[model samples]
Target: MNFKELHNQKTPLLLGNVWDVPSAKTAEKLGFQAIGTSSSAIAALLGYQDGEQMGFSELIYFVKQIVTNTNLPLSVDLESGYSRDPIIIAEHIKELVALGVVGINIEDSIVKDERILLNGEKFASTLIDVINVLSKENIDVFINVRTDTFLLKHSDVIEETKKRIKLYENAGANGIFTPCIENESDIREIVNCTSLPINVMCMPNLPDFNTLSSLGVQRISMGNFLFDTMYSQLERITKDIIDQRSFQSIF
Candidate 1:
């Protein structure tokens, strides 16, 4: 199934975010209709922190590996498109599309000493340029515009999110992703405010698939949770082996 049809499923599309070829293969083997990359996960795997610390060449190579091995549609989490210039961002996206990427998540947050969101109007302008470039190049990539209002805990989050969603939709975003939004009322409000597919990240307080589906969510992404959990388990197993001086932990 195509990425668009995956969103239109009876149940919300669940993307098992993978950071490497092994993880991508595992998710695909487990019957995930599509696979997504977590920026933080990819960064950590490459011995860097999140926020585009991994070089673009390294990232593209990693993505090419997954695309080469997996049959599922892949959506990459390109944090802020790896550049401030919209034309450069579009070029980066074109490269990914050439590597068989079907979708991408581009956020509006700027990562500096402190995380700050870009101005809504300015972000929308950049998004329009990126969309225009993609259209000109004849690349039909799904642009998932992610807003950081809830992630950054902005005071007027609901209002600001709604406003940005409207702007981004007009800017040609195929979907809206609001990570860290757990409130039912807020989710409902955002869902009601836009016709675009809603993509929510998995968080501790976020509702389950059934609850989210009822809230009109179309896509549910695990983000970096799986990678974090896998490493956490690995840490536990290693500590167990060191303390007990036995191979029982492997069993």
Candidate 2:
């Protein structure tokens, strides 16, 4: 199935990301129409760090596994497309498409300064080339261009967010992802920028389902939150065991 077509919905497709085959099946059984793979969660599962830990070959294997286990259209988190070279990144995009991924989340948040950094003009330049290359491949790969400005820099967050969206749209991004925005006004500004779908991180204490739906957010991702929650829960239980305290089911 062409995954981008799924996003052309009256209500945005709410994708639940899975790290492994079982998780993908579980999500599929839970009535989620589409399933995504989390790069963080998958990397943690394989005992590696995120971003280029596993090369395209290994990533292709994982995507194939996810596809084999379930029939849902898969959207993969190809962390920074696994390379800096736009040609290599484009090749990786084609590899993912060959592996049956219907969508991909490519981000400009290159790891630097111990946080996400946005090289606005450079990333935009690369994105245009990447999209152009993929178009030649003749696959309608859904590109959810991720912008990490809000998560990294807070100064004039609204203006920076708009700038990134404009650049991404010009680069042919199917949608725009602003990972963590604090307030509703900022979300509104992004919503007003372009008609393309806007994506947000699903923070527990932040916007509720109704609020997100009202804000015109077409996509909401859990990112590493689910993986972090798993780690925290396991650590808490292990600590309780060491302390001889009753580990009641907190799940």
Candidate 3:
């Protein structure tokens, strides 16, 4: 099934976000329907900070590797498309489409020295331009528009999120992602306000899969949680080896 059909399934589409070929293969082997890249995880692997610190070429090369190694439809977390100019962003996306990527997540936050979100209307306009370009090129990539209202804890988050979702949907967004939103009531409100499928990132405080599905969440992404957990395990194993002077942890 295509990524769009996966999102429209009765059960929520659970994405295991991966950083490399091995991780992508593992996710597929374990029966995930699709593979999504975690930009933070990829940035760490490339020895750079997230938020576009990793070069676009480096990111694309890494994505090419994953796509080459796996048959699952891949969606990339292209943080702000790596540029503000819509044309440049569309060029990056077009290259990804050529590389066999099926979808992407683009956020509205500006992640420079300080993390400031773009104005809702302006971001919507940017989405419109990018979508127009993709359409003109006959690319069928899913555009998941991410708004960081809850993640950034913006004031009047619910209302602001509703406004942004409305504008983004009108701009041709395929899905709406609002990460860090754990409250059931708020999720229900947002889901009710928009016809576009809702995607939520995994958080400790978030409800379980059944509850989220009932709340109208069509997609659930692990984001960097899997990568972060893997590294934490590595740290623990290294400390164990140092303390006991043994390689038993590896075994």
TM-scores for the candidates: 0.98, 0.90, 0.98
For residues 39-108, could you state the per-residue lDDT of candidate 3 as single tens digits? 9999998888878898899999999999999999999999998999999999999999999999999999
For candidate 1, write residues 1-251 as lDDT tens digits: 68877888888999989999899999988999899999899899889888887888888989999999999999998899899899999999999999999999999997787779999999999999999989987999989999999999999999999999999999999999999999889999999999999999989999988999999999999989989999999999999999999989989
Greater lDDT among 1 and 2 belongs to 1
Q: Candidate 3: what lDDT? A: 0.94
In model 3, where do residues sit more than 4 Å from their true spots?
Answer: none
TM-score of 3: 0.98
Q: What's model 1's overall lDDT?
A: 0.93
lDDT of 2 by residue, 1-251 (tens): 35666666667678888888988898899998888888888888778777667666777788899998998988989878778788989988888888778889988876543556658888888989998898886877889988878777658778887888898898789988888774787787788899898888876555875787788877777778877897898898888776875655443
Q: What is the C-alpha lDDT of each candidate?
A: 0.93, 0.81, 0.94
Highest-lDDT candidate? 3
lDDT of 3 at 81: 88
Clashes of each: 0, 0, 0
Cα misplacement distance, residue 128 of candidate 1 (Å): 0.5
- Between prediction 1 and prediction 2, the one with superior TM-score is 1
